[model samples]
Target chain A: MTERKREILASSQSVLKEKGYAATSVRDIAKALEMEPASLYSHFKNKEDILKITCFDMADKFELAVREVNDIYFNAEEKLRLAIKLHVEILTQNLDSAIIFIRDWRNLTGTALEQFLTKRNAYEKGFREIVQTGIDEGVFNETDKKFAALTILSSVNWIVEWYKVDGKLNAEQIADKLSNFILSGLKKEMI
Target chain B: MTERKREILASSQSVLKEKGYAATSVRDIAKALEMEPASLYSHFKNKEDILKITCFDMADKFELAVREVNDIYFNAEEKLRLAIKLHVEILTQNLDSAIIFIRDWRNLTGTALEQFLTKRNAYEKGFREIVQTGIDEGVFNETDKKFAALTILSSVNWIVEWYKVDGKLNAEQIADKLSNFILSGLKKEMI
Candidate 1:
């Protein structure tokens, strides 16, 4: 995408986050970009198209961030912490896109929705594998791997719903707090 | 609510869950109950009113379920375990209402929105205090109480999203799985 198109999506995210996808129209996205509706249409077909791109962009970011856990040193614990930190940063730093990513995802249609779900399931699998591997290495407790993964993902994914840019905890602070809380649960200790 | 009114609301929940708040109309709700739209409007001013009631009914159920944890003996760990179990039961048992509770919450307006948030915060406080007490009792690990509460709540509150009625794990099974996983995280042991 060109710099101008990226600017348009960013502006559209602001409107979508505030008014929501159900209420937002193509004209609204164009208005936010200060471009004529025809010009915006030239760049994208419609509001849903812009939303699809915006949601998928965040998905790609999530896929990229979670994959970075592979690069961390051999400690599953450290890898888990870094994964949480980077994931939280991606959402917090791109706050508007993050909000749109959750709220407008339901509005995606047909192949767009399927594509989103496919990427999402793949992203979740990547995240779950980290937890699964932790358990396999005996670094984490012997618990239901899928449930543990769901709990970890749910706790972090939920932050997108309530996180504020100027909230009490910064992204790094929340990341540490959450990772500690989750890692504590997963660590295998001698009885 | 009258028996007939309660029945109408229950029927509305099904339509709302399928079509969502924006798309599900008074006609859709009325048709689900085999009533005329005019009669449905008598019971509910519009789709939003039915939505408000649906969301709050689930909220009330959640509040009642959490309050039951207090009735158990004062083992903080037991209380926390039972809390997760009961919370999960309320959500999964009233599965449709729980779905609407999360998805359609944003559609609530004015006094209904304020009332819902007020009840929700109080309900969260109820759940948090259990974690807070567990931490003080040393049954749970020393962690940021609020962070602990959020993580605990996130793990259980999230059950509403993915739980399937026909899924392999029954309510009791999920409860045991989640509570065990969470309690393990909070148990104080040698590092």
Candidate 2:
């Protein structure tokens, strides 16, 4: 995307995060950018178009992050630690887009919604597999892998809701502390 | 509240969950109940009134649950277990109100919003105190009490997003598995 289009997407994300998807309009995006609504129309088809792009972009980031960790030669424990760090970094650095991705994706309709859910489920499946690998390798305890993945993801995904740029703990600190807390539950008992 | 008023509140919560606070109208709630908007006006001054009540009522449920747990003689570990079960039960049993309480509370304005957040913070603080008690008793590991509390709350609270009434796990099952996972993380190293 061009610099101007990137700017529009950023502003649109901010407005969507504030007013929410159903209530936000193209005009609201335009107003946030101090541009004409017609100008925004020329750049993007409509509000849903912007939302689709935003949600898909976030999904792509998560997919890429996990794929990178998967390609590495780390064990399940290390892979999960890196995954948690990457997830927290993406959410904290892209707060507006993260919030919209989490809260406003329900607003997408038609093929967009279907595809979004598919991508999301696939992403979750990838995360669950990591937990499964840990159990298979006799590193993590044997438990419900689906429940474990969801527990880990939900714990980290929720950081977008309460993360502050100026908070006491930065993204790395949160990722470290949270990873320890979650991994403690998943790891096998020490003899 | 009268039976009629209670019915209105229930229907209003469903509408709010579907269309969101910004997009929902008083007419929508009336239509959901097959009543006229004029009739809704008799019970609710406006849409915000219904929202305020829904949010506060959910808060009251949580406060009561924690207060009951706090009044009991259970140790910190058992107290935390009961708290998790009660929290999950409230969310699953009252899914609509839980969703509205978690997501739509942001739409509240002025004094209502302030009071809602204050109550919410207090609730979080109470949860943290339980973790602190465990740490004080050396039952839980020495870690950031605030972070540990938020992690536990976030894991369970996110259940509202994916909980299925007919899903594989019932509320009690989820509460059991989630409590086990979270407590494992919080508990100190067992010799």
Candidate 3:
């Protein structure tokens, strides 16, 4: 992408984060960029086009984060901790796009919506498998793996809603604290 | 509220859940109720008024749930479990209002927004107190109490996004499993 195109996408994400996908218009994105609405058309097709790119880009980052963890040699407990840290880091680093990815993807239509959901489910499935591996290996508790995975993801995914760049804790500190809390829950009692 | 007013609020919540607070119009709420837009004026002053009621009503349910849990004589662990169950039940039962509560509150303006946020923070504070009590009593682990509370609440709150009325687990079962996971994380190791 050109510098101008990247600037437009970033501006669109900021507007979408505040006004949401359903309420945001091409004009609003242009206004955020201080450009004419017609100018946006030269860079992108329309509002949904921008949303699609923003959502997919954020999703790609999450996918890559998990894939990198899976490539490493670690126990499920360590893998889960690293995954949580990477997930939280991605969310905090790209706060605006992360918010759009979580809240506004439902506004995508047709093939775009279908494909987004597919990628999302697969991403969740990947997380679930980590929990399953832990349970199978007797590292984590013998709880419902699906529920455990969803609960863990929900706990971390919600960081986007409340994380502050200027908050007392930076992303790494927040991640460290959160991972400690979550790992305690998933790990079986030590003998 | 009269039967008609109740119907209007319910319809408003449904429409708000779908179109969101920023995009939803009075006419949309009216259309959802199969009534004329002017008729809605008799019940709600405007779209924001409807949103305020929906948000506060949901917030009241949450507040009341925590209060009830606090009133009981159970230990902190059991109290947290029951609180989780009650919260999950409220969200699953009033899915539309809960969705509006979670996703659309940012659109509330002025005093309504301030009041809503106050209630929200207080509600979180109440949950945090439960964890604080646990730690004080040497029950929960000596982790960061605030992070523990936020993690537990976020884990439960995200239920509104994925919970299906006809999903495999009922609200009670979900609460049971989730409370186990959460409490396990919070509780210190038993000798």
Candidate with top DockQ is: 2
Q: CA lDDT of B116 in candidate 1?
A: 97
lDDT of candidates 1 onward, in order: 0.82, 0.89, 0.86
Compare candidates 2 and 3 on DockQ and give the better one.
Answer: 2
Better of 2 and 3 by TM-score: 2
RMSD of model 1, in Å? 2.4
Question: What is the CA-based DockQ of model 2?
Answer: 0.71
TM-score of each: 0.91, 0.96, 0.95
User: Model 2 has how many clashing residue pairs?
Assistant: 0
Alpha-carbon deviation at B109 in model 1, angstroms = 0.6
**Candidate 1 ranges with C-alpha deviation above 4 Å:** A25-39, A71-73, B30-39, B71-73
lDDT of 2 by residue, A65-158 (tens): 9888877878999989999999999999999999999888888889999999999988888788788878888999999888788889999988
TM-score of chain B of each: 0.91, 0.95, 0.95
- Candidate 1 clashing pairs, residues 3+ apart or interchain: A185-B185
Best by lDDT: 2
What TM-score does model 2 score on chain A? 0.96
For model 1 the TM-score comes to 0.91
On a 0 to 100 scale, what is the lDDT of residue B104 in model 1? 74
Writing each residue's lDDT as its tens digit, candidate 1 over B1-191 gives 89988888888887788757875677777777787888887777776788888888888988887777776667888888788888888888888888889777877889999999988887888878898788778777777776677778888878877889999999989999888778877777645
